[model samples]
Target: MRLMTIFIALLGSVAVPGLAADVGFEEVKITNGAEPPLTAGIWYPTNAQGTSHSLGDFTQTVAPEAPIAGSRLPLVVMSHGGGGWYGSHYDTALALAHAGFVAAAVSHAGDTFDDQSRVLQLWRRPEQLHRLISYMLDEWRWHRRLDAARIGAFGFSNGGFTVLVAAGGVPDLSKIAPFCDVHADHDLCDALQHAGVERHFGSNVPASAWIHDSRIRAVVIAAPSFGFAFGRAGLSSVRTAVQIWSAADDRHQPHPYYDEPVRDDLPRAPGYHVVANAGHFDFLPPCDARLSRMRPEICNSRPGFDRATFHDQFNADVLQSLHDTLP
Candidate 1:
């Protein structure tokens, strides 16, 4: 694990230079069904130039210690992929803040590598995302720094599925046949059932919740997991505009998962982009040298795509879409 951490850090240090900026970070602890809590990293543009700020070891806060001048900046709630932490998406968050939006990436209680089992982590992810959104709305209102009407969500992999559900793109968990054989007694299966993923994750929310709530105005999903095909009822329930993008060579979830179903069910308001030679990990900052040294697979996957190039273009596309869509 130590090696893996170093690998990811090295990746970020090397690859992030081209896209990185001075984004400030802060910690916000939210309840995760249990009392003493889970936390998230809130990244935003800073007022100070050149100077850097550090939140703590557990939390990687960077940039100017002072808050920047901005009123009602559009807010984006980001969800990292499986086995990831809030700091993992620093590049994305910083990019968005520099582009003029405040980005908050939640460190899901059960999903992060530090504290939770894989199964429990996967199961609790979607609910955590919703709760985070609800909590952020209140925070935004009180802080008066977020434009509630211009909220957006962007996520990758499992986190991708989180935003999909938030955006009203429902999946039928019962029908989610796993490609790899997982044991029935496995925590993964148990957690999946506990979360009621079949009922909520891929399926649309109730009509009442869908039509009345306007906090989430748009969504962007990258290599979203879960089947892309929306049920007839689910497709009809979607009200928010969406932007979907995926790599042609995504080794993790593949294009078929989303491409086919979205083509048939996604409404006309949503936009789609495909990166010709990208892979799943491209969306994340590079793996640090330590991890890459220990596990080569962590750094480079089955060949073809250049992770750095893919992400550079993907990040630009995401920023552009949000700027145009979010007020």
Candidate 2:
């Protein structure tokens, strides 16, 4: 009798979708008053028709403010890399939404494209993700349409570091100064030096402040920054399913210091991939002609590598990982 009552209540909040459904898109504000307001872009499944819209570097076709097609759907919150915004991976978010999952990405206030205030403040990113999830499950207008138990995350570069921490991995940021001291000539180290990063950047912050939320069941991290920070000890508490990607020919934060540590340290082997001849930014959505010319460093893949082709498979793989892991 009790089980039947629960089932009936679940059905009451859900709406069945027709055979044809398009992606839905909405930009929402997440403000908790403890920090700056975060502007988030959400993509989800909807029965309404959609039209093409340009969003910064990428274009998307989604039904604006369309009511969700179904109830109790899964959610995947995205975290963009340093200097990136919510639209950085619009294609991935849309793909997830089309596959019946709510995908969202937030523009990290102090570390976004126009603001580099907290670019090196790695400790802050995880809390931003934690807050985003809290809002989606407890405050979003469509909260009841989501299955709180099935939530995942996807991130790249510094954003990769964020998801790792959110999944219960504790990075020993103290390793940064020492690693950079020895490998200052490395691409990532050189860039940090150029960014005016101080050696003791995260020293004042207490260790407990590096936030983690157990709610995230799965994660996809690509070409993570500060990868050396998560040694075996740092990754000891991480219990979520993980898929980690690294660009084989990445010049920015190459092997050994970047993805290698997390790969070898995680308690269990994560689904790992090393894309041959790919660079760090290849993990992002395929760029249009204008963006390609404007930011060749991020847009261009290595010789004989096709980014558009790779992304098709990448997006498919990400969806599959979430499907396999999320209940």
Candidate 3:
């Protein structure tokens, strides 16, 4: 069966121009945010030539090899941590794409580093996820490339919280008391209010849009924060299967974010994984010498953990979960 699958995959590659080569990465402009339109990188199996171009300078950095074709591929949407861009998880996206899945990493407009406006950052994430999913479904229906039946979401940190929201893990915003003092005209305060961060939906975007979206087959969260407030009621209500993976030594966010609360809640839901030695930054790309020199403090958290190995293993686990859960 494996050999037959390989043969069919090779035949499919020959039929499609860039179907069996290394993964191809392309920046797709998605109109989903308030301003500074969201941009996401689409990673998919490509032909040899397309693969070469896709790898480009990333060959030395981190690039994922292509996967065999023939089988119907799943679709995975990746959301990055707070203040992170789509490029931060580029390698992870490519890896999933090469593993016979279409992976898209979105750069939330307000949340990215380039645009540090707190207000927009908080307000736009949910909307962006909703629009992006809608767009992907439309693409699958019209382009005839993606398998709409198998779709999942994977998010890290703030993105992790967003995935919960996408999975119907709605928290009572009132529970998220301000970690700091707030003043009038403060963008952070206003943004948080607008996003219903400490509350629920104040607008027409129904909570059902996430819980009831039949297209989203599964959800995977990494080092999810704010998940504690999204109690069992919210988590248990999700129709789609869920898999959460987190690290015990995550410094940026409290370990309890995963261990005590989130993990405690998962048994009632579906699946979850906890890595012992992992850190918060393990999901991102490997830090280069330049980053170490320029921002030592940031890279110093995970002393001996190998970023490449961690991300690769994490993605592999995610793919396995998707394969088991989704169609």
Candidate 4:
């Protein structure tokens, strides 16, 4: 593993710098009058050199608040999974920045690691992302540096469900109870029990809550939860191109339950990839020592799997997919 990590670093030197220059990093508190300030992290290309810096437990080479280097750069708004934060896909964000795109990830309020109060309220997620895109294109300090027409989205797990809706797919949440009743052995059912979520999570959510933004030209979704809910009819309206990913051995949001339905139901054929020997949480980056100790479940891959190596290809593929659609 140590040797593989060294190899990954070496590859970064050769694999990075894909369509742009050095990477810049920064955080923002988006304050729109209609909602509480949102916490977000952004990565973009820069002409300035960046030094290795610690952001909480993780470290990355980033030019902090460096001057914007590119004009009208492509923008990608990221939505993290339930109980995840903006940094959940930090490595991917950095890769996007290195590839000349501005990547912004939001710590979905009330559904983040620090709070799960709105975890079951899936309808609000796409709306949150919509607001995020609006803030980036209209209010962000670097708003003028972005190209609104080339906007895209990337999401994982719950976030997967989110970007799909934002791209005009509607999920029939009413399918939850019936599905759960039959698949009671699934981890999603167990998670719901621990989180105290009622099966009636779909009730009373007006159609208006599922906001759709046609501006998101493309999306990349990984192991989306609640996939069954997006039946053929529900996913019929999604015209935006998409790239879908699934872990072959995912234990959490397992097969035919999560990624399958979306892949099968989407009106347009999506670019899909399933990683062999990968688990559900393997979609996250290779964990740091401290993070591994704290959450080994999400950190460790199967005996033979190498996450650091896989993410190299993963990031490149994600980058290519975005550029193909957004450009």
Predicted model with the maximum lDDT: 4
* Error at 235, model 2, angstroms: 0.6
Better of 1 and 2 by TM-score: 2
Cα RMSD, each candidate: 7.8, 6.8, 7.0, 3.4
Candidate 2 stretches with Cα past 4 Å from truth are 1-20
TM-score, predicted candidate 1 vs. hidden true structure: 0.75
> RMSD in Å for candidate 2, one decimal?
6.8
What's the ranking of the predictions by TM-score, best on top?
4, 2, 3, 1
Residue-wise lDDT of candidate 2 within 1-327, one digit each (tens)? 222233234334433221125888999999847876899999998889999998886777889999888888889999999899989888888777777789989888888999988788778788888889999999988999899999999999989999999999888777878888898888767877887778667656666979999999999999999888889999998889999999998888877788998989999899999999998889988788898899998888888999887887787778778878886
lDDT by residue for model 4 (204-251), tens: 666677999999999999999889988999999999999999999999
Candidate 4 backbone collisions, by pair:
none
Residue range 1-327, candidate 3, lDDT tens digits = 222233244443233222344565556677754566577767776543432342322342223343334345677888887778877677667656555677777888767867656622333576677767777667532235677788898888788877777766655444444431323233334556666564333334344444334567788888776665566775675667877777777765655544357657653555767777777777666667767677565455466777666665676667667767765
> Compared to the true structure, candidate 2 yields what TM-score?
0.92
Which portions of model 1 miss their true places by more than 4 Å? 1-21, 33-35, 50-61, 118-123, 140-142, 177-214, 301-304
- Model 3 Cα shift for residue 16 (angstroms): 17
The per-residue C-alpha lDDT of model 2 at residue 279 equals: 88
lDDT (CA) per prediction: 0.61, 0.84, 0.62, 0.86
Shift of residue 133 alpha carbon in model 3, Å: 2.0
Question: What's the TM-score of every candidate structure?
Answer: 0.75, 0.92, 0.76, 0.93
